[model samples]
Target chain A: MSKQTVFLVGATGETGESILRALLDDGSFEVTCFIRTASAHKPSVQRLKDKGLKVVFGELSDSTENLANLLVGIDTVILSIFAFDVGVEASLIQAASMARVKRFVPCGFGTPCPRGGVMALRDLKEVVHDQIFTLHLGYTIIDVGYWYEISSPRVPSGKFDYAIMVPRNKVIEGGTAPNMLIAKKDVGAITARIIKDDRTLNKRVYVCGDILTQNEINSIVEEKTGEKLELTNETTADVRKDLDQMNRAVQDDPSNLAHKYRLSNAQYNLSKYVRIDNTPEIAEYLGYIDGRKLFPDYVFQKFSDFVNDLAAGRVQRPYPHVSL
Target chain B: MSKQTVFLVGATGETGESILRALLDDGSFEVTCFIRTASAHKPSVQRLKDKGLKVVFGELSDSTENLANLLVGIDTVILSIFAFDVGVEASLIQAASMARVKRFVPCGFGTPCPRGGVMALRDLKEVVHDQIFTLHLGYTIIDVGYWYEISSPRVPSGKFDYAIMVPRNKVIEGGTAPNMLIAKKDVGAITARIIKDDRTLNKRVYVCGDILTQNEINSIVEEKTGEKLELTNETTADVRKDLDQMNRAVQDDPSNLAHKYRLSNAQYNLSKYVRIDNTPEIAEYLGYIDGRKLFPDYVFQKFSDFVNDLAAGRVQRPYPHVSL
Candidate 1:
């Protein structure tokens, strides 16, 4: 059988890199990375090129026609860019539609929250989803909840050095609500499987390695590292208060970088920890196919295993820390 | 004060014509109509041009940069196009943002409905709304419920000629819930007032001439015409069943024109008659300023007056009949 041809954007980003590596390792798909011309000289991009991956340099600001021309002959187009780049993603979706690509995997790799919430980013992502759905594009929307790489507290092992991942070891309301977590690498593997599976076409797929509350995750880490981590508890009301303040600040001065950053952080915390709508049951209610159920035999790395890796210094933080 | 330079799309459309007439009649704003080159030779475009209206020929499919160039020097951009032209509207919004237009009025001149409903068109409009808000473009979303021109029952008068306006004299579910209604001409006049008023900036404005149930409207029409029009009542459940069937048909064949038309008709019925979420209280709850409250002294044409005009063969249907 002929190999499936894939075109990917944001391949240099953390999630995109994981998907790229997984697709490459599978050796069953012809992968092409669509990197920005500005990022063409990046070592990460160059490394992908050296690995025999096809590279296409273009700008997201390019005309839809131009983007469509570039997407010609591609069977599937996968977007993994930042959620804020809605306009870019919109243009890409239009371009993919024009190119008559068979399938489109949009950038929605996160928790499943209801629309019209305090999270402005989710609203933006909803716009992209509506565009793809309304255009009747063959698409697969994958939400892998929170990434396991960023779900852990800062340990004494020093391997996971991102302080912003869990600020001050503060967990929300004891984190009693079950939250879905997936390793970043597993997201790529699951995405690869999802795009190729006919059942996932035009549907939302929920991929998760484990479903554990923040307290459960912390307990697992403590057992693995043999050290108790001091934790601070914050209520959802507190998060809501912070979110309201941030919303007002952003509304007052939308162009202020500091205000925008603070608003995004509050929104992220609210979505990841404060909200209790990230469980498998919520995913089912939202009409998401269970990835674990779909691939029952495929073993997924648990939170404990990730904690072991962090304590053993075998894994490192995937993204840099941006101090709030 | 200098006249606000206004750029308008869909000037030849029913709602656009109303807005264009209102803006021109107000004599307080300088209006320029952006029309498609393909429609340049139409009588509507020529008639506008003859009235000393500035007409710019361009297509919505034009590049964002090209559209932005045309929007230069315009203080406000008004979109009165069809709701289905969401992609076109998004590009125009981008261009408006790029051109630094002070305010944008999106194409949402209809009953106020919540997002993510069975009405796909509402979802499409939401996308445009999100884009304008996310881009930090100053925007005013105006929703003027059902148009009075089509809201009335068909009388013996030959002036009101559209049969599709209220097909078979069918009304939904006893119609006890108050539904907002506004004259098409009033929509344009209200929109003109809304754009000029500083209060409506970055807000949603709900314009209504009357809030009456279907039975109330029918009684008003019966009194005006001195003739009882035969009416058939349909329940909300019946409309929902039709909507579901149409939805399935559209899902099976998205490109089928018949299925699309049926789906849209069912959705329109559901939003207009079946749904009770279009009242002033609902609008206020949804953060919309009441247009009637904003301009208390302004005389609005009530349903009784509209019925009288229809009986006297004064007002004509703005839109043509599309057999469904």
Candidate 2:
């Protein structure tokens, strides 16, 4: 009957920040953010501390002993950190298990990685998931296929400074894959609810604000903004081919840090948008059924709702650059 | 055209060693084995060197500049290393590009890693594939689904130290998924041919010795060996559930080296046998069609031929523990 003490990693990013706000607003759980000590001086961290959020200093890549110390007395650990080493999440999971955290949620706020597909980001998720599963820890995985902000100018990851799949003037050719896009705020709210709801324990939980196709999204943008953005007719195959070429280029010149960054961005984008064939079956496969059927009591915010919110300026601009 | 030069990585491995023998026997291409400097003292490396095979000492994880130096004047680079760091192959790829190696063959002699699947081995393959593609390097991906040695007592990879799927007396219950398996010798022969044939450039070259379901494979063992192994009635679902649990255990204690090894073996076995549903379409998808029909010129060693060879003591008993 006691309030759960929450330890949150990746508290500075958009999703992490949103989740933090939701956890604080819930007023039932005690929230603590585990951030890198070096980045603790950032304004965002300062603001969170000012809001009475407990901020712990630690790096995910740190030794398990140190991470365990950080997770002590924390009932739940929610990770929203970006991918670093493949072992980072595994290390955190080890620490949480040592500390005996009641529930652990590793960052999965995307599509369910295909069972045997290769995609570094998705594979990293798999590695972490394998470690979590092997450890017999109580866990929850959130699968939000894509973010609407991918189509917005202000990027959350900040690696890709512009829109990827659905930029202002360009839509991928045959952009009809049913995109299960979720808002950062919705992700936060839903995650907070799931944390409170014990039913989601040790299971893969699905969260999506709306399921919209690229063509449908393009049309919605036109309606909302009163302009037709350039809809480029490049296919998913083209993106994959180009990704392959660019990656080779990176290999050719390991000194090209810019190309490596570009490769990373492309890899992330391809995993998010191009890898999975866009189909209703895929949407249904990626927890659309579970998201709707399991959480019958909760109403999800729709893509239209998000667009309407954006059009009415009821919400802040879609993508806000979050400082480190 | 001048005789092509091949810089082969992992020449001491089971498949790598076989490929090396075939390439040497061909006498058309100039074959150079790029091995780790640390492994230069291994008997296998010494034997290859004794055979007048060019054994170049350079680790795949070496710097691009150094690897480039090792790959200088190499016409093609073929990687046959086991799953290791994602960057190792990428580093070699960078070197190959720098050295202007005309063709690069990555290690993908297994089930196709689904585009966004979480399977770690497949994901590693994906990572290597991405680097190859992004670099705009020439590539020939050989997807040989599974190896027949999984049922053989003589395992190639000494780490597992035992037959994984086909234990002496057990069979997965309802094991009906058709496994597309190939012989290491066939793989060697076909690869050598592919290297000589310019038609296979930049294409996904499929190769299969045989495709058989677990039930069929079990029956074959019974017929060939005149012994009925205990047919354990475990389902794919069971394997997956157990994998999930075992993975959780690994997460709980990341330092448990045995657990990590078991987890890796479990992952590789699951990807090879359990993950994909045994549908005819999937069989076609994993290169069965192209392997069986596309290359009429190449005759693959059949499963029957392999069993007969084993019966006659023509093929060396599998799972030979080669000293490093």
Per residue, candidate 1 scores C-alpha lDDT tens digits across A1-324 of 999999999898878988998888888899989999998898988898888889998998888899999999999998899655654677788888999999998888888765655477777777677677545567888899887877888765554563225433678877676889988888888888888888777677898999998889888877777877878888989998988998998899987766877887688777667656677765654456688788787777888887777666666555553444
Segments of candidate 2 deviating more than 4 angstroms? A1-324, B115-118, B152-168, B252-261, B277-280, B283-289, B317-319, B322-324
**Chain B: TM-scores of all predictions:** 0.93, 0.86
User: What is the C-alpha lDDT profile of model 2 across B1-324, one tens digit per residue?
Assistant: 677899888888867877888888787889888878898788888898788887778777789999899887888888888654444677888888888888999986666544434466666776676677555577777777566665543222232233233342334546666666787787888888887777666666666777787667767755777764544476667667768876997899987755665666566556556654223344333322354465678778777667666655555434355221
DockQ of 1: 0.02
Candidate whose TM-score is highest? 1
In candidate 1 the C-alpha lDDT for residue A275 amounts to 57
lDDT of 2 by residue, A66-160 (tens): 89998889999998875443357767889999999988888877665443344556667766766675455777887776676654432233322
- How is the predicted docking of candidate 1 categorized under the CAPRI scheme? incorrect
Question: How much lDDT does each candidate structure score?
Answer: 0.79, 0.68
lDDT by residue (tens digit), candidate 1, B194-311 = 9998877777889899999888988887777677677778898999999999999989998776688779778878776765666776565444677888888888888888777776
